[model samples]
Target: MTIPRSSCLLLAGALAFSACNTGTEQQSSTAAADSLHHIVHRYYDDKMQLFPIDATFNGEHQYDGLLHIDISEGFRQRLDSFAGRYLQQLQGVDTSGLSSNDRISYEMLLRELNMTRESLQFHDHLMPIHQFWGLTLTLPQLGSGTSAQPFKTKEDYEKFMQRMKTFAEWADTAIANMRKGMATGYVLPEALVVKVIPQLRDLASNDTGNVFFGPLKTLPAGTDTAFASAYRHTITAYVFPAYAKLQRFLQEEYLPKARSSSGIAGVPDGKAYYNYLIRYWTTTNKTPDEIFDTGQKEVARIRGEMEQIKNSTGFKGDLAAFFQFVRSDPQFRIFKTPAQVLDSFRAIEHKIMPGVKQMYALLPKTSFEVRQTEAFRAASASAEYMQGSADGSRPGVFYVPILDAKKFSYVGMESLFLHEAIPGHHFQISLQQENDSLPRFRRFSWIGAYGEGYALYCEGLGRELGLYTNPYMYFGRLSDEIHRAIRLVVDVGMHAKGWSREQALQYMLENEPLSEDEAVAEIERYMAVPAQALSYKTGELKILELRRRYEQLQGGQFSLKDFHDELLKDGCVPLSVLEEKMKRRFE
Candidate 1:
């Protein structure tokens, strides 16, 4: 998700909304509209700055010197306090006279606040931390070299070390929180726990090759040699040992109580949590059964397409063997280097731009780039797009993992570029950023259903965009598409139906030739973020439905260019909201 300049050119507006001069009408509306934005921005700024670790990620630097939060019941009360204020502000906002764009933003903001407050009622604050995705380990990544935190000056180095000292306190607090979670039946899956233990075990190493030692390895070249060495020594001798202690605690204490079950249904109010997440991500009231059924139908349909391709290609082998052949073929191993991997993506970009322009008039002003996945987290990563700063200070990027380029096939590379980079995330997010009327938060969000769902819909356009040409390559797209469809079944099956990791993997391999490694990683992601995989197909299905209706309604009048521009202009909205926008534009 490291936003680069190649595959994702999110050239957003360079200036913030601060630059627009005000007329009396502008000033009059500004009183309400501007106040609304100001109040929301102020809330986030105060909340994040008050919690410095959060600040560092959002490109705010004022709280770099701070770490550690008082997450006692008192802290939970404070979160409730903030929620109350925002809830009131959301209630007070008048959406009747607002522009359509602002109305959408207002609705999103309202939904987000209600959801958060409802979630907070569970005092998830009481379970403020867990080993799987804790802040203790993440803070180091935020501050050190190659991180968002600027580390050139001596003060920056000193600040990180100071941050490490406070981190120990956070780790202790994290353990305390986990203990609280255990008493409330809010433990992570035993399967997920085992995986996390190794992560801590890996980080527990003292070697310079480790990610934490990155600051030591790439200390600013101009720093005094004596100071650099001393700093490195301090981190290795002290910081590593502290992290090791936290790791030991994870190994010794937490893993024992971790549940074997995978679903939120296992935890307190877990079923409700899953329901909230479903509506939250999908932006609809889709029941688990509904999503599960859709997943099955889609998987069957996509499989039918694959079988047709297999027939045309005359692959005489059975379906599973064909999957094996497609995945394991020697010809697919053309990428021997990172440059080769990037070259494959570049080739895709060059070949597809004309086709892209043919279908869509609106394009992101941002440029895109390709980069290796950030090495630290690459092991747990998938190909993803990282959006650029809304202000266009940083270009949107596409990150491809080339950990073993030769081992990874080039079959599905182009379709992936289309999804993760241009004409997908970069296009959608950049369009949102450039919309001067959108509330700031709407421009930057993590709505898995709408955002990721729409991205998959974008991928459905691969052939028209000229990427999925060869039969093998087209099959590859089908293969990737099946994976998402399968996620709906397996995720629900594992958590809801009590299917084990081995069972899920067997089901996947029966249907597709994903390497054992790839299958396991994909399934674990489902475990980590349940029901998220369902969004793509669910959302994609709706989009395809919309397109079909439009084609039927417009007949020969249909303009693909106009269709695309109209869709992209609304950015990421709830499916229903998107439907409304499309109807207003096209009907």
Candidate 2:
């Protein structure tokens, strides 16, 4: 989930409707349309300035020299003020005559603005970064000169150095915010804080071998030999010292004072914050109790299927025993080298290609490759897809954290690929980014429920793609589904139901074939970002519901390929908007 980019490239636009208007209609609509268009463009330009790192990641080079520090009170006020003004201006746009797509864009913009405004009520900035993800975690990757931040030119290197200096400032601000959070009873869990200390310690060291020196090792075939020494000195003088300062703050100032409690519910107004996050991530009105019950039902249903698979394998013991067998079985861990692991994924891709070609009518022209996760963060990383640059200069990458090839299991490779690689994030993101027909905002925009949900839904498509033929692979698919199902329970359980970290970890160890380390890492991830794990299931279930309804209503007339194409045609949108669109098109 520590993927390079974050949420959608978004705003409103009316250009999508231009082609359908008659001369008189065009003349009447043009002025209003032009005003709406100008407003959207201006909003995007402003956002690019406010969150320059995000802009850099979104393929806007102009902001690469800067970094936005939202941890500051001033920055928060600026963001909230911007959101309010944009919301008002956008509401003034007349949507009655806009095209359906443009109307959807308008609705999407309103949803985002409203969400942004509502979120400003909380003290989320109090806890700016965590071990799992955020600016702190991503800075190393960007500093390595391998991610979205370009390091091809001297100016690029200079911009990155400036960004590093800003990062040091941001780190200081984060410490200040953490202090504020402590005073306001908004501190992170002790377990999460413990994890954070080590990461900071790792980052702050005067280790020239750090990721910040990655560019110096192998210059990007440019005439930058002289600058490497200066950059190295900067890392030592500025980056390392800044990190050391942050590490000292974490170890000496913050950790002892961090709360021993596990859930955010223990904090001030924590219950309200959790509920708000539920809506924020899922984009739904459902209560946490509703999602909890849904999770219980899904866990039970998936367990039954897993049981059936266990019996089919003629395994003698109960589900727990089978889980242990899968966890410990040497047969599953046949991968000899990292290359073999990558090759295994390639094989799965090849095996499913024909079916993939037939299943979806539209495909991304953006190329994809499978690689190992970067060394710096691989220990805590998950298998995830990094979206390519929209301009097609970089290929989307599926990074698998193969810490030890000898222990790598192929059991989950098929399902993992289906979720993170071809036909999952790569497919969904690339097509969205590649589709020039969509407004620039929508093209890069992603709603977790819509985007991640679609990827989770893709996990089920393995059966149709001639995968999961091996009983172990089938179990892997079940295991993956149960993983998401478990998330729904534990994410809601911890933050809302007072479930302890130990209880959540035990629940996962009992249900899934995860090592204790893996289970612990996952539980902490949910703790760090509450209600996020719920999005995978919440979004996937909606997509699956739409698919089922379309299949039943259209019956023999339903075109699966066309259905898929349409589902992804508009890129990522809120589930509600997608449902409305589907009903209008099919019903």
Candidate 3:
């Protein structure tokens, strides 16, 4: 569920032209290449200014203290003008004379510019502060001094204060936007609104234990008591009050006006907006019905695998009964402490080490770690990987939400580790960042179909990783796949086909071995962010298809390590683009 932060702007790196195979003169080709490079570099620079937070997360700290609140009409007009200017400039270049890699870059940038412009047509800013991806959720993580925002120097502390003030202003803008949305029937789902209120209340608690005081608690080897005292006073006097203002607004002004319906289809222009989201998430032309049907087929296939595992365990019951048994079995919930749960994941890492070496020829030099999710947000957060600092100051982290050790199920741990830790996000993201050849944008870019799809594909490597030997553990892997497949069906169904929140929740309960709370959380996630859940299965199927085609064609010449190496070398791209790249190289 975690991805590297990406800019909404076209943040592509400049690419050079390779030797031309076209019948153009070398001088003309060279001129075209130079012009395109200048255009791309300029676009990259402008995007960094436009999305300072994304730049800061990607290790560029030039705009450290600045925060951009883009909900205003003036900001929207400027952004639209910016996107239009870039698109016009990009189209002016003669792409026919460019190299293959340069062509890919040009196409990718063009797609991004067009998509960004199209997205502005929808009023996403109105319902912006969702439980999953809103500023309300992310600001605390940054302020905690544990995230990408650094706190190593006195100036770093000052920058944080300025950013906090900017955040307060952003909060005011958010309130205004929500009011605007209310007038236009663009409010958030009431269920999600209720989830967000607690988060705001926690941040706005105005206590010493609040995460804003985190940096002051562990000063970076400094002897600056006076400065530290000032920082604390600032947080209490200014920052905490901002959160309190937001909390009051949410509880008193926003919640009652929130939408009663669960789907985006309830809002004005919501149907078209959802269609845009589908295209944005999947990076494809496939319709909602197509994705829903694909989910159905994948669910059936995984169910058959789960049934086989059930019979192997000698369970004398139907699939639903077996699912219930796995869901509540005390034997599977043996962990007594959070440490034990984390240790089990470490054991999974050790068990899979050998197979990982065999599969991936080029491993990331960046260090990796498995950690417990922060206690404040753990309840609602899914187990996810956070990208490390490119300089290796921060290790790539896999954070598991061990809400209650006794409630933790061992069924999905092995596959979960494979997907979120080694050979999945860690490998894909670290390798991308470490490669200096990639443009800064590509190094940190995310195409969910490529990124999440690759992670889901990693789950199938359980047998290769030497885990999933136990029948129940194997079922756990199948269960994880079914979880994604169910998302495909229910995400589109709820948004586009009139399926209610309860219908989606019931579908999950009938098919997967999830607790009612877990089911509710997953359903609400889909409601908050539409079409994103489809990426896992869609991307995985495409990659698997390509792997099969290459394996059959290459026969004895094929190498798994080489396939993985090439697959990840280019970082993330649209599935159609990835398939074409793989075909030209492998086929």
lDDT against true structure, model 2: 0.86
After TM-score superposition, the amount by which residue 285's alpha carbon in candidate 1 deviates from its true location, in angstroms, is 0.7
What TM-score would each prediction reach against the true structure?
Answer: 0.87, 0.94, 0.94
- Per-residue CA lDDT of model 2 for 428-469, tens digit only, reads 999999988776777767789888899999999999999999
* Cα RMSD for candidates in order: 10.8, 9.5, 9.3
* Structural RMSD, model 2: 9.5
Candidate 1: what lDDT?
0.74
**CA lDDT, candidate 2, residue 221:** 68
Error of 1 at 226 (Å): 6.0
How many angstroms is residue 291 displaced in model 2 relative to the true structure, after the best TM-score fit? Answer: 0.3
Query: Local error of candidate 2 at 210, Å?
Result: 0.8
Tell me the tens digit of each residue's lDDT in model 3 across 3-48. 3446312233211122342334567777888887888788877888
| lDDT, model 1, position 139 | 61
Candidate 2, run of 10 with poorest lDDT? 5-14
